[model samples]
Target: MSVPVEVIFKRPEALRDRPTHYCPGCPHGIAHRLVAEALDDLGLRERAVGVAPVGCSVLAYNYFNCDFQEAAHGRAPALATGIKRGRPDTIVFTYQGDGDLASIGMAEIIHAANRGEKITVVFINNAIYGMTGGQMAPTTLVGQKTTTSPYGRDPEQIGWPIRMAELLSTLVAPVYVTRQALYTPQLVRKARKALHTAFRLQAEGKGFTFVELLSSCPTGWGMTPVEALEWGKEKMMAYFPLGEFKKPEAEEGGKK
Candidate 1:
């Protein structure tokens, strides 16, 4: 009895088949897959260029099957701007974390979005710093404990976590800005759609697309994989609500 089995899903050509170095249950892998799927769907893999800065995803170049440039901490947006401007035909993107982005890279990101650079940005905000030990980041929430803020983040002294999607949406030049998460299956599906939208807009030469993903860092958060997922869904989602903060307005072609 020879029965044939069909393959329903497979690895994206935009992603390498290498073993993952991410922690068990870390959402970085899921986020990677989503980005790869978007590139594959748009046939943009050949022209895609990714810029990765210091942080957990610093070694992102090793995982993705595309050209990657390494930039100094908080300088990804600046570097990406140059790359896109120089080679307007290529699809350039940056993969950054909260600490690398909202903290030191804050000015770089804001300015790039304001200028409407034709590039896509994938931001992974896990609240606390991930790669350089669990320290309080610009996106760390009040009462969240980290290595530096062992007593929990104090709003009086540290202030609140930055809502990047909302902040960037306020800018007039951006074509797309949205926040999504991977804590649940439904949310993960939505995140994939968001990624698709971001990449699709960039392919059409739309200026400045940003996708903020609420990622889970179990090791940094000091919780089991399951607990970290729950914390992201409950605490993180409450503060950084997921949805489109901005979208492209109708153009001459009736594109919205």
Candidate 2:
């Protein structure tokens, strides 16, 4: 008998044919897959609009099959808020990097959360800034060396890495917040589920939803793809714990 092929290997309809621009071993590709899968799961492909930020994954518009908009550096949240409010019927999502979200766009993100913008935010926290070379990002861990911090990040000089999920959870307006990783098959599955929940909240007209994905930048981290995966589990996971920080209420008032 011939071996049967599984349907799991097929690409999602929400993914376009354009070859990915991410560097070999870069986790951006994985993140894209998770987002596409979420859209597919929620049947939101046609009505979904994605905002791409100015970073290494700036060209995310090319990979996702849904409508896409380019936002100015660190302004994705503001742009996404406008898009979501203007087209309340559609599902709006913003893809941002650590540098874009935790740095220059910090105010926008916090205020959007405060207002409970009904949009989904896919935050890719890869520690270092990948687009303009491997510089220290706001999420870079202490003792982690980047181009801008050859001596490693110091809490006294640079302060500690920002925990976006925790910070967003403090805001009362957000309906959902979670941190997930894409380093392994199990973790990837969890990340997909988290992404799906975020989009679901958007579809339900719930408040803001944020999913911080701990990803790797192999080229920037100066490690091979395999090494980077190991490093993410050993180093990144310690700082950014993976779990749901908040969730929508149940019909009876309990946590959903």
Candidate 3:
């Protein structure tokens, strides 16, 4: 008799039952799924420890099945540092949004990269703040309007969106840095690969892997999910070009 094949299309063992608390069309859920899938693919679900930040994903602990620690606003890297230092055997990672990572946590994120912490950071950049009533985030586009930037982001007052992947790549300590978007089917597949690569780098004990995902916030952006995805491709991608910023071998010979 021929052996039978089984197919499965269910939640990963590393994810929990609580449906995501994200608004409709928010890409946070997709990002969460990608992270969970990466953990499963690396066989590190049980050994993974996630540090949830204070933003849209603040309650990420309730969504992921692995052990989690809730960090204060902009303190996820600091907390993850402690966790990784204490339990070097555990695969530590942090999930943070643009407001949390590029704004209040900028120093922490930079220092962590400078120190070459053996951890992975998944950064969701949706342009504007998704939580707290759609305020302007550090990654908000120059022409984007939020509650705080009702008249659109004025470059005179507010600077341009921070290119996080490029900024981190300037540091020599990190081993991997990449920027990917999830606005289209092909981009989504690319994002999955980037997430998987980050997890793989962590598994290999490579230093400081960072993946910045260009996500969408439809509700906050005052558009349908489909429209927001289109905007990301037409506008967001122009400013934040996708691709790996830094890799281990590239830096080995002093090349960026």
Candidate 4:
């Protein structure tokens, strides 16, 4: 008899079988894989709906095996709110970048979280805008150089980088809020756990949940993938430390 080998790795059924458009070493691919794995593990692939806004992952619909909708720039949260409300049985989520979530979509995200919409949000904070150009974003670290900030970001004029996880945690409605990263294998594992928690919260009808993943944009940052990951661990992690900012009570399946 021939010995059989166990399949240790394979694409999640929730993710479409297609090559991603993300540049080499971009963390978006990791983020997508985590989301797909969560959907598969949670048995939500059949009903999960994703909302993708204008950004690097704007083509998200083409990648997810589940249904996906495109939202206007900075408006993914609002769109997700509507979808979740109209189809409460469906698992709804929004994948947004720093430029779309923290900048133009600031108010939309704030209100949606405040309202406790039954939705999950996957926020990718790469610090600099990656789609349109390498421009300064609301989450850009101070002294970080970008196309619009050739001299590095000036706090005196641009203000400090917005801490979305901390900001959203201050609100009363969100069931869970966390900041994670994908720079290392260890961090990537934690990020996947956070993603799973956010989705699990929504599956249980626990109000709004948000997980911010600190990602690297090698092309935008003008560095190799390895260099970007190193920079992220040294600088970005200093500003956006990874941890759960908030969670429901332990009795309610959240961290104490």
Q: Could you give candidate 4's per-residue lDDT for residues 78-102 as a string of tens digits? A: 8898888898999999999999999
Estimate candidate 3's RMSD in Å.
Answer: 2.6
lDDT (tens digit, per residue) of candidate 3 on 47-150: 99999998889999999999999998888999999999999999999999998999999999999999999999999999887779789999899979999999
lDDT, candidates in the order shown: 0.93, 0.92, 0.91, 0.93
**Candidates in order: C-alpha RMSD to true structure:** 2.2, 2.2, 2.6, 1.5
Question: lDDT order of candidates, best first?
Answer: 4, 1, 2, 3
User: Model 2's lDDT to the true fold?
Assistant: 0.92
Best by lDDT: 4
Superposed Cα RMSD, model 1 = 2.2
CA shift at 74, candidate 2, in angstroms?
A: 0.8
The TM-score of candidate 1 is 0.96
Q: Which is better, 2 or 4, measured by TM-score?
A: 4
Candidate 1 local lDDT, 1-256, one digit each (tens) = 9899998999999999998778888999999999999999999999999998899999999999999999999999999999999999999999999989999999999999999999999999999888888999999989999999999999999888899999999999998998999999999999998899899999999889999999889999999999999999999999999888888766322235
Q: How accurate is candidate 4 locally (lDDT)?
A: 0.93
Tell me the spans in candidate 4 whose CA falls farther than 4 Å from its real position: 1-3, 251-256
lDDT of 2 by residue, 168-202 (tens): 99888998999999899999999998898889878
Ranking by TM-score: 4, 1, 2, 3
Note the residue pairs that clash in candidate 3: none
TM-score of each: 0.96, 0.95, 0.94, 0.97
